[model samples]
Target: MKTTTAFPQASRSRSGWLIAISLLLLLAMALISLGVGPVSIPLETVWQWVLQRESQESLSEFTILSSLRLPRVVASLWIGAALATAGVGFQCLFRNPLADPYVIGASSGAALGVATSVVVGGTWSVAGFNPTSMFAMMGAIATVGLVFVIGSSRRGTSSLTLLLAGVAVSSLANALVSLLMFVHDGQKTMVILNWLLGSLASSNWQTLPAVLVLSTAGMFWLWMMARQLDAYSLGDIASQSLGLDLFRLRLSVVLAASLATAAAVSTAGVIGFVGLIAPQIARLLVGTRHTLLIPMSALLGASITLIADAAARTVVAPAELPVGILTAMLGCPFFLGLLLRRPRTYSRPGRRGG
Candidate 1:
């Protein structure tokens, strides 16, 4: 009995350590990111600036930190966390390790929306959201809604059915975006293309509030569903038998995740793989308790995004690669390796043995 109790306690201790380390890593990455851009600042200086302590850095350096890098880093942190948290939710909801926030056509729909806005050449703003962001959010929500409606049955929503529906919608939306890009003028096309490739170059204090609010709400909502999601791992019938409303859970999760994805894609432009990679890595580190998994995933996601964003800014120097491209470059290899490795083993929490 003591041995049995010791094992669970040991696992908990390890998870706690991992979570603490993840938080520290995320903080370190955020600081590193703030100092990484053109005209680099020192780490100590970055820390001083963050803490509002006097520093020898010039006013221009301070301006760059405050006006530019800070917001972008903050955006990356929250957006990554949101995407990763949403990823955990979707993965549990779907019972598929490969499932991500964008698995349900949110990225494609947001891309289409942004592409449409760029083509239309609008300068409108509503409640801190530009025309592009507004359209992106609308597109994501609508696409998710469409997929849910099509995928859901009278009995309940099946993961496989929803997955198929998402794939179809995503393909259609991607096609539409491509068509728009092909038809538009070169300059506008380039704008849309850059956005589709995903860049945080545009993230600024002016536009971050809306993203923060939406993402926070979505993440918190999803976190609240942690128990339901955990119950789901017992299988759909078991979950339903436990007085969990399967339909409501599906709807709430899809909606919450869509909200977070829309906020992210609208700001960062369809960054992928953070959602897929972070959650899996988190599960590997801390095991599969949704309560721990969700927060650990958030930290890992934030750290990964910061690293990718920093690399995107500096890897080419002066000519920045889109962060999204960097993430894909990183993600694709990881994804293939995930498949080639013990995918079945990795998919389960705390049960690595075949």
Candidate 2:
């Protein structure tokens, strides 16, 4: 019997149009998100503001748009894109449909790092990164390293082992975070809880630049490896037989994904399920080809994040809900549905009647 891969060459032809549509949809969502909040700015005004054609009478709108909403919107886009792109990288590398930063403990670890920093009471910065971000990056990398080490054996890491190890590590990290919150003062505890729940409300111009740079660099590096990921999707033996260096591919993917995840967690405080949900949806739409999948996933992720943020802001006016809570509510059901399905569900990408 001939070996087969999930990604078919035929899908490549439509990737351009798919990405174009996704970009358009993401733009629409961003525009809508900008206009939604405690004070409603009309979509028309939002568009006018975007074009720098705002009337002098709309100065208040301009202040809210430029000073408040824009940074949060931009952060949502970049952070969501980073997480979703990292999800693609992780799922490809692990050859597991369920793999993601949140599921694999990277987010928990990063959050714990941030909590630790808060407890330590630090005012430190390195290369435009505050102590929280530095610790987050380190924690993400360390947790991923631990998972790989624990999952590895004489035959190397298996998907099941990695998944199980990740769950155990995630639980451990979460517990430690809770302990820190319990031991700290009320103010520190409040800060830790806020970060844990995940909010883009605090995203401002000051920190947005660093997040943009890190996420862009990390996601770009992953995008460059799309070809390798597609090859790896063919399975370990086949990819290695094709002269693909599995070790190099794994290292590159893990590092890039971890960096992206860290950037997101540090900025948005560990939003869950975007990474898990976005790539699967993208794969269903565009097939398993990472080139198409990456961009589509990024756009979808951005749109989802924006919508969640909009709801978080407006759902309880004056008192906002954490964006993470909304994503978790949406993702939990979708994740459970995916889990209940037969294993064959993922055998063919973009095929509905599998």
What TM-score, computed on C-alpha atoms, does each candidate reach?
Answer: 0.92, 0.88
Cα RMSD of predicted structure 1:
3.2
lDDT of 1 at 214: 95
TM-score of 2: 0.88
Model 2 C-alpha lDDT per residue in residues 115-202, reported as the tens digit of each score: 8899997897887677877788778878988877787654766666777888999999989998998888999999888888899998
Question: Model 2, poorest ten-residue lDDT window?
Answer: 1-10
Q: State each model's CA lDDT, in order.
A: 0.87, 0.85
- Candidate with best TM-score: 1
